[model samples]
Structure formats: C-alpha cells, structure tokens
Target: MLRFNKWSLTPFHLLTLLLTLTLTLWLLNVCFNLPTWLLLVPIALIQFLSFLFFHTIKEKGNIAVVYYCGYALVIFLLFKWFNSMAITSLTYTQWLGSFMMVPQPVFAYFLSSTLMLSSMFIALIYYFVIIHFRPMVLILISALPATICIRMGRPTVSSYLFIFMGILLLLYMYYCSYEAEELPYTVLPCTKSYWSTMSLLLLCIFLTCSLLLIPGSNLSNPIHTLLRTQVTNHLQPNYTTSTLPKESTATSAPTALSDTPIFEVRATKPVYFRTRGWDYYEKNAWHVKREALSLGYQLPKSEMNQKLEQKSLVLLNVIERLEKNGLLQDMPELTHLLEAPISPITYYAAYVTTLNYSHYMYLNPPGLISISNPFSPLDLYLNALEICFANDKTRPYPNEGYVISYMDTFPASNSREMLLIESLDPSTYNQLINFLLDRVWEQHNLQQAQEDEYFLKKCSDEMETATLHFLDIPNSITKRTYDLAQKITASSTSTYEKALAIQNYFYNGEFTYDLNSPVTPLDKDAIEYFLFESKRGTCVQFASAMTMLCRAAGIPTRYMEGYVCEEYDASKGCYIIKQKHAHAFPEVYLPGYGWRIFEPTIPATENEKSPLSLILLLITCLMFLFILYFLSKVLSEQLWRLWIVRQEPKIALEAIYSRLLKRLKKNGYVIEVSMTPINISHILLEQGIDLTWLTEHYCKVHYGHCSCDKTVVLQALQLYKFLYHVHP
Candidate 1:
C-alpha cells in the first residue's frame, strides 16, 4: 500500500498499451496466419481477475485502466474468429475475387497493431505530466487515418506505423519530463473527466457505424459479372493466363460453351431466348409437369425409371431490354402458351427471373415477347428435352454440360418435306413459279371497288364481321374510338398507311400499362381499371387493349408476343433484340395472300406524355431526409456529453486536494489553484487548519458508498470554482 501511488498507471498509459498489443497480434495473424486466439487468453484472464478483486474506490483508477484494455482485447479476439471463418469459407482462388468485398482479416491486423502501438505512445507521455487529456484525442484521430491506409495496402504498414509511434511516444515522454520541475505527482488527477470523454467518443462511434451498417427497406442484387481468372489469381500468386498450361484430356463429347465465346451469337435478326417450360397451371400457380404426370395425362415410363419424352424444337435469342425482367439471355419459345402453333416457325420470347442453385423455373411474371405460326396450316407442338454433355473439368461442384432443348414434333419434318416435294413435283420449277404469279394477279379484283365509292361500306362490313368474332365494344364508344383511329390515319389509303395511323391513335389514347392487375377483357367489352385509376401497365395489358380496339373497328387483327429490337446495332447490322417485346397489331388476311403485320400502338406525337404527378411527391421526399439527418446529429451529441460526465479520475490525490481545500477555506486560509494542495495542507496542519468538516464530508462522499448529498456536492463545486479563479 505504501509503494502504490494512484497517480501511477494513468489513463493515458493504459490506453497506449492496449492499442500496441492489439495491433501487433492482428498483423502477426495476417502475415503468417498465426494463432490470434492464443494472444487473447492471458489478456482476458488478467482482466477478469482485475474486475473481480480490485473494484473499490481506492483501486478505481486501476479498474478503469483494466476495463479499456479488456475491451480492446475482446474486440481483437472476436475479429480473429471472424477472419478465420471468412478465410475458411473460400478456396485460396476465391480469395482474390473476394478481396475487395470483404477485407476483414486485413482490417483485424490494422485494428489490433496500430491501436496497441498508439496507446503505448500516449502512455509514456502520461507517465510524466500525468495529463492524459489531449493525447487521447490525438491518438483516436490518427488511428482512423491509419486504419484506412492499412486496409488499402499490406499488413506490414501497421508494423511500420507502430514502430514510428513508439519513437514519438518516447520523444514526447522526454519533452514532458524536461518541462516539469519536480514531476507533477503532487498534482491530483481528473480520472472522471478523461474516462468520460473517451467513453463518449467510443459510444458515439459504435452507434454511428451500427446505424450505417443497417440495410434499408429495399434491396437489389449487387453482384453482376465476375471473371473466373480473378478468383484463381488470389489462390495462386504471380499467376498469368499466358503462363498457365491448358488441359489436354480427350473426351468423346464436346463440353458446353467450351469453344464458344462468352458473348457469341450469329443471328442478325431478333429471336426469343428459351429456357425450360412450365405446362401445369394450378392453384393460381404454374408448375413444370413432372415426367410421370401432366394435364391429366401420365407419360409412358420405362424400366430404367425414366419417363417417356416429348420432342420439341424451340429457338430463342437474347433481347437487349430483357434484363428488366431479371432473365438471362436464354428463354423458352415453344409451349409458351396453351394453343398449338399453326406452323413450323421461329419466335422470340423474354421471360422474367433467373435460376437458383436448384434447376427450376422461377417467374417474375413480367410478360415475355414472342412470335409464332406466321402463316402455315399446321400447328406447332413442344416438349422440353434435357441433354447432357460428357465433358467438363472445373473444380468445386462439378460443372454439368446440361442444356434445355425444345422440340416441335407435329407435322413431322419428314411429312413436311414430302408435302413440299409432291406439290412441286408435277410442274417444272419455273412453271410452278409462273402459276403462283398468275394466281396472285387474278385475285386483284378489288381494283373495281374504288369505282363504287364503297370505302365507308367496306369499313362497316369489316366492323360488323369483327364484332361477331372478337369485339365487345358498344356502337357509340366504338364509333368514337374508331373515328379517333381514323383521325390518326386520316391521310393513309394503302394497308401500310392505315396501319401506321391506327398505331398513332392507340399510342395517343389514355391507355396505361400495369404489371399487377387481374386479368380483364378488351374490345367493345374493354375491361378498364376503375375509370379514374389510369396507369401504364405491362406489355400484356398494352397489347390486349390494342387488339380489342382494332377488332371493334372491323380490322383483322391478332396479338403477337415476340422479341422486338430496341436499337439498330451497327456491328450486327440490324435491329438487335436484347429482350422480348410483346406486341398486338392488325393483320389483314387478304384473299390471295396471307396475313401481314401492322402497327397499332405507335403514338402520332413523338414526345409521349406521361400521366404522373410530380411536384407534391418531391416535397414529401425532401422532408423525410431532413428529419432523419437531424435526429442522428442530436443523438450523437447527447451521448457524447453523457460519456464525458461518467469518467472517473485515476489519482485519489485530486480528491485529497479537494477535501484539503474545503478544510483550508473553512479555517480562514483561502486556497488557490496555483497553490499545491499538498503544500497548503502541510502548512495548515502545522498552523492547525481545522479539518473536521472536510473529513466528515469526504468520508461520506468518497467512502460511505452511498449517494452523495446535493448540499455537499454543491459545496465542493463552489470550492473548486473559487480555487480555480483564486489560483489563476
């Protein structure tokens, strides 16, 4: 007890030691993968014992030191566990690809090594002057910058930082010692003020980072594309593609996409992308038909336990705009709808949602674009096929060379070939061409219809026939919208001219696109969202609306879902379809020829107006931002103030000085800050400065272990204020 000075092992010295040990252990772990757990054991044991046995007011100074050091130790060990788990989860190769996203182990080293070294620097200065105040602030500020730099670079940076810090700590200690006359041990410590300030800063920082780390309500997929080489590089140092040897193993089957470039496609025209199919729509859900059962039909099963197969042929291409649906480049075309195809033809399709680990079809349900059965008599049929290649050698989970295949088996290829050969075999090739030409010319009898001034009659005839088949439009609204369509195409005479005009009208009308809507009908019986609830819907709604309206006008029309090109690609030299665009248009089925595609949704006005409310929305959003920012600032400031107030001073000499001052003033000798409390107390004892009041108050406030009386606290505060001014 005689050798123990409360002034020794000050707050500044304790913090310095803590920062030094933490940084060293962290760096060693990073460079050598050394055991960080071993270093934490003794630090933890000492802290536990210190807290259990040395908690009294007389030993409170030591306890505070132990507490901060213990905190630093626990943080280090926890980080070590996190680093080990992170590293173990990935292969050495995967580490390189993941380096930037999760740099935890590197962070651990910086936190441990720099913090310990910085604390040591501060501790030396504290040893002499014993004012742990400003140095603590300096150390914290420097630590942040150090952490950032070390994280960006190598583990050795932390070692260099600590060594330099050690030099600075020793130099600062020498300066403080020279500046002091007899050392400031006679001056009492303000342990409460120091610890309080440190605690507040730490609390504020922790709270701030925690809040920032919390994710917002909405989230999106952040990972897009990663290079395979990047993953391999981390595992193997100094690896290069040119230097790496290639695999020479021979296999009977060609690997999927092995020789194919990642981004290679030969199609110049837009085509639908095809994945697997879901044929069963039940319980408000669409499910893929298991091989054993489909729409009330069981497929044949073989002794090998495999189900009978359905052959299907499907062709698809990546669309530029399909990413909006979260789909990849490949999509399924055949069996996309319930109806059978009318011909062996190609179509485009865009589907939403990508695959997960399990091979299943997940739909975002956004409408896909596709085109099928342009003009043939026979309908197309489709069934999914699973084909697996025999070769692939990637690591981890074995890469399977499996691909989804679509087959169209009806009106078999052999039958179609026979039909074409029999039809043309009776005539010479040139004679067959001449006969087709003569038939086409003979059907041009419509040239005389213009002489009858029968344009209006023709329109009415089309409308009447269309109403009987598809349209549910009332005569009055039908006339008005039809006139609106005519006003759009008032100048057109030919089929192309009329088609463009109708396109302009629908584009200009108050039609909307919606993704989340119940199925509704169109035409004279157009299903409208509540008359006031106007919003642009998805492609399905937009296409359905146009088809119904055109049918009411006596126009031959059909809705087509297929890929549409968003832009004309210079390299591809055509409109490249990145995504499927479902479209509905009028198709005039002519007498001699077949149906031709017509546009109906094109707006006459180039700048399409959006029906959205904007100003009020902006003001509401700004107000939310201001409120969140204000609350955060206020919380941070108040928490800081509380932390500073809670600090307990290290040296009991300050309490002793305070008590002696109270006694001196009561005994008629005015105490001052410039006057050392020890010297003043000695003089008073020699001259008898009656200390009865002070001894009683000090015992009650400092050792009674009960709440201090307000009166006594107020008296102490008044005494310190008076001494501060008088001593200065």
Candidate 2:
C-alpha cells in the first residue's frame, strides 16, 4: 500500500513541490506538446483532492481506480455527443469561458482521460518529492515521459535537468530540517546562532543565483546533443534500403567504384555530403555501434551481435557519495567551476537533390539540421538529424529529396559543430578533474554510470561516453600508429589543431593514394597496414588511418563517407554529384565546434575564416572571466570561513584580527603594522565607531597571552560578525 509520511506540510515543502512540479510539467509538455490546461488543470485538481483524500483513505489505491472510471465514462459520453466535431477544434485553448465557444464535446473526453492519468502521476510526485523527499522515485517518474518522447521523435532534455537540480535541493533541505532545534523555520540549515545562519543564507543566495542564472541556452548541454548523434548514427541506416552504395568503409584492396551520377546539389559552395558518421572502427570497417535496440525498431542480426558494452546510465549514486560526505556548504566552488563560455551560432542551408532513385540522401557532417520533407523533425542543441525509421514505403523523404542546414561551425566549410569550449581554458578543467580525482576513482564513476537508469546520469559520464566511444582502438591498431599520431600532433593544443596536423601528415608524402593498391595483410589492422607496409591506398585508407591516429592522439574522431559534390555545373547552378565522387574522410569532434569533417585523403584545404570567430572567442573568454569575478567573492568568503574554522585557536583568532585590520585599511584608515589593538580601538572610538568588542578579544589573545579556545573563537566569531555583517 502506498502511504504518506508523518512530516507536516511546511512552506519549504510547498515551495519545493511547486518549483519541481513546474519543471516537471514543462518538460512533460515538451515531450507530448500537451495542452497547457489539460496537463496543469488536472494535476492541480489532483493535488487538492489528494491532500483532502490522504486524510480520509486507508486504501489510497481505490482513489486511482475511481478517477480512471470517471474518465472512461466522461470520455464515452463526450465522444457520443460530439461525433460531428473535429478533434482539432477540441484543444483547450480553442475554447474560452463559454461552453458554446467549444462546440466540440469530444474535447471533454480528451480532458477526462488525461485528468485520470495526471491524478496517478501527481499521487506519485506527492508521495516521493513532496512528502517523503525520495529523489529516486521522483526522477523515475519524470524520466519515463521524457524517454518516451525521445523514442517517439520528440526529444526535449531541459525538463529532466531542472528536476535533477531540484531533487538535490530538496534532499539537502531534508538534511537541513533535521536541525529542528536550531532552525526558526521548517527548513533553513541552522548554524549555532541566528547571525551565522544569516551569513550562511546570504552565501547561499549568492551561490544558487550564480549557478541557475549563469548557465544559458541548451547548447551548454552535451548529453542532449550526444543523444541526437547516437540516434542518427543508429537509425539512419535502417531508412535507406536500396543497394545504393554506402561510403564509410576501408577495404584492403580498392574496387572500381561506379562513376554514375547519384545525387545533385544546389548550394552556394561545394560541401562533402556525408550519409552519417560511424563511431566504431574495427577490421577495416567503419561500424555504427548499437548501444541498444532503438526507436522501436530492431537492428539486423549481423549488426546486433557485436554491441558495445552497455555502460551505467546514472550519476545519483556518485552524487550521493559526494554530497552525503560534504558539508551542505560545498556548492560554491562547483558553481564557480561550471560557468563556461558560449559563442553564437549562425546556420547556412544546403540543398540535396537525388538523381538516381536508389541513391541515399547525404547530409553534412555534424549530422542533419533540418530536412525539407515533412519528416521526424526535432530541436536539439546540437541541431542533429532525425531520420525517419519507418519502412521504405512509408519513409518521410520524397522522390525529389530534402535540404539540410549546416551551422557556421561545421568544419568542412562549415559547424558546438557539443562543446562551447571543451575545457574552457584548462585551469577550470584541471580544477574539476582534481576535485573529482580527490573525491572518487575512475572505476567508481563508471560503475555508477553503468547502474544508472536512462536520462538520469551525470553530465560528465555522458560526456565521457560520447567522447570515449569514438576514441576506442581495436587490438589490431599498433603502438606505432599511436606513436605516429602523438608525434605528428605534438605541437597541437586543441582538437582542431591536432586534427589539422594529422590531416596534413598524409600530405607529407609518406602515404600514396592509389585506386589500384595492393591488398593489405589479414594479420594487420587495415589502417596500420596502410600507414606502414602497404602505404598505397585510396581515400579509404587515408581516411581510416587519420581516424585511428586522431583517436590514438586523444582526440575523438569518426570515419565519414558519402559522395563529394565538387563538380559544379555553373550554367545549371547546382553541383553535379557522381557515384565516382563517393568519398570517405575523417571527422574530428572539435571541443567548441561540433563534429567537423577533415579532408585527410588530400591536403586539407586552408579553411578561411572571417575575424568573427577570433572576436567571438575573445568575447566569450571575457564574459566567462567577468562572471568568475563575482563568483570569486563568494568563494573567498567561504574559503576564509573554512580557513578560520580549521586552524589552530591562536591562528584562527589571528586570522580574524588580520581581517578586521584589512577591512579598516580598505575604508581608508592609515593604520601601520606596528599599531597596537588598544591604539586601534582608541582611534575607532575617536571616530564615533565601536569595534571595541572585536579588538578586545584580539588584544587578550595577542597582548595578555590569554588562551584562545573554542569559547574565545565563538567570541571572535561574534567579533567577525560585527566587522562583516554590521558593515560592508
């Protein structure tokens, strides 16, 4: 039997419930695009009824059955009465205050059915988030709807994130409430005194506001973008059924690829039209790894057998370990570290027209932005492609084809094309790494991630998963391949630079691009064979070698293949793409940009850039630093408090004494280092100021040689309060 706890409803409880529920409803609506009143009105109604019903019922299960029955009967009557009205007019917003305005009674039925569903959900949220403060249950309930929406082709992740933060707060609130004796209310964390509590509260206001307000836009989210990348990589292949040639592969020997024209492009400039990016490379094959069966469709048996090892999907356990141990005061540094730089993105459109009926539609590298056809469109921060997975007869693309928009950050002329700044200057990243390492081990994070449920893991774990998937090298890849990659990119600092260096390495004349190359040995990895022994292969080998080498050099790279439409028919205005133009290349996942396509088979084109990117980089850096300046004051106060608390009694007292003198000096007093505590007190008294209490304690510890103990420290804390809390 589901039950409520003994705790009474407090203001903190109500506020937590309201904020969490608001976030939950917003995300749920994003998932289903539910009518505002349909979702809210029912949930609000259920909350009131549940509050009333919890007092009356011994059996809570009976209420759900009754609500659902009411829904079925109401729907039946509405549908029968309004059979003539279209369902489109039945939207909640379509009607106003009058029943006559909503001629469609079927809307009543839809409302009733949803009302029943909302009652059941509100009951769970009431039990978990509001009453019991159980994060796992609330997270489970919130995640299910979001997951369903993603699979149904509507992916909105922002809702789930807000709820996660809310859970942390409520969990902390639960801990704070334990100090009932000291707290004046049901929830604020109690220090020993009211003034210290005031200090703590002010500090919290600074930290929380800094965190929630600073992180802007959905682009800051990598898991959200990576999810789109994973979705496109897996489902896109199932759409194009024609034996039309696919490009992402490396064969030991070259075969005469057909020169027949496959697709035509109408664009301002030439672009590499990629079918999709393959993250896994093994046995000379660019494989799209199947993490699991996805989008309600099963992969072919050949592809399904070799699945990547499933990883932990959750971060709550690791967070539980981290938070349970830290004083509730640990969030300041986290907020300080998390603020990253975001640059603006501008998008350009590329039109792809198919000439052969069997040819697959090729998209630009970061994946699809949007297609012209009325297909499964989605809004991702990364703006990735969402391909139709229905059977060929019912596929979304038409015979004429679709247009894909590429972001300016697109590496190929184009494309986060997930990251704004991968580490945002290594200092912040190092701080994060050192903090994580100091707290936990590598194996623990992974284990927790493996056990985590979908859509409920850490940002770091998902970020790790997305990057590491592309970095894996099969055993066939030699150490020399790794060494060569590292050696070539030795001077490079960023992913793009490393990628550029590796791309240009092939052009150094060490490898040959031959269509009639000799077959590579079965004993060697195809890339290793090409780089060392054979040294004579086409775009296939060059692309594959660069892909592995980049991975070895600690850069996440994927092999991409599709037709290159460079031959422009200027009179016709669209570039003519041929089957012979079917090409393969390496795409490196640049930190600030999204997945970028690089031409490693030939010398990389010297990508020209306007001064805007440099200007954007400098501007973003300044903004990050500007925010950091404010966050630092909070951190400094917190650190000083920690420093005072942790030191020896004499040192703690001296620290407070030194701080008081510094504060006075800042206010324009010309006190010397040799000034006596008595002399300072006299000068302060002469100026109509009184810090006699603070100076007296410091004088006892320093001049009288009186012992400084916990009592003296408390007195010094009172002294510290007058210096900071009473003044500036």
Clashes of each: 63, 13
Candidate 2 runs further than 4 Å off? 1-249, 293-344, 359-367, 374-390, 394-399, 410-462, 603-728
Best candidate, TM-score-wise?
2
Give candidate 1's TM-score.
0.27
User: With candidate 1 superimposed using the best TM-score fit, by how many Å does residue 233's alpha carbon deviate from the native?
Assistant: 46
Error of 2 at 144 (Å): 59
Stretches of candidate 1 exceeding 4 Å from the true structure: 1-477, 481-497, 507-545, 553-728
- Cα deviation in Å at residue 335, candidate 1? 35
Q: Model 2, poorest ten-residue lDDT window?
A: 305-314
lDDT score for candidate 1 against the true structure: 0.33
The models' CA-based lDDT, in order, is: 0.33, 0.52
Tens-place lDDT per residue, model 2, 67-153, is 656645764565445433435544444442222211233445445444545545555655565446554455566666656543322
Candidate 1: residue 197 Cα off by (Å): 24
Most accurate candidate by lDDT: 2
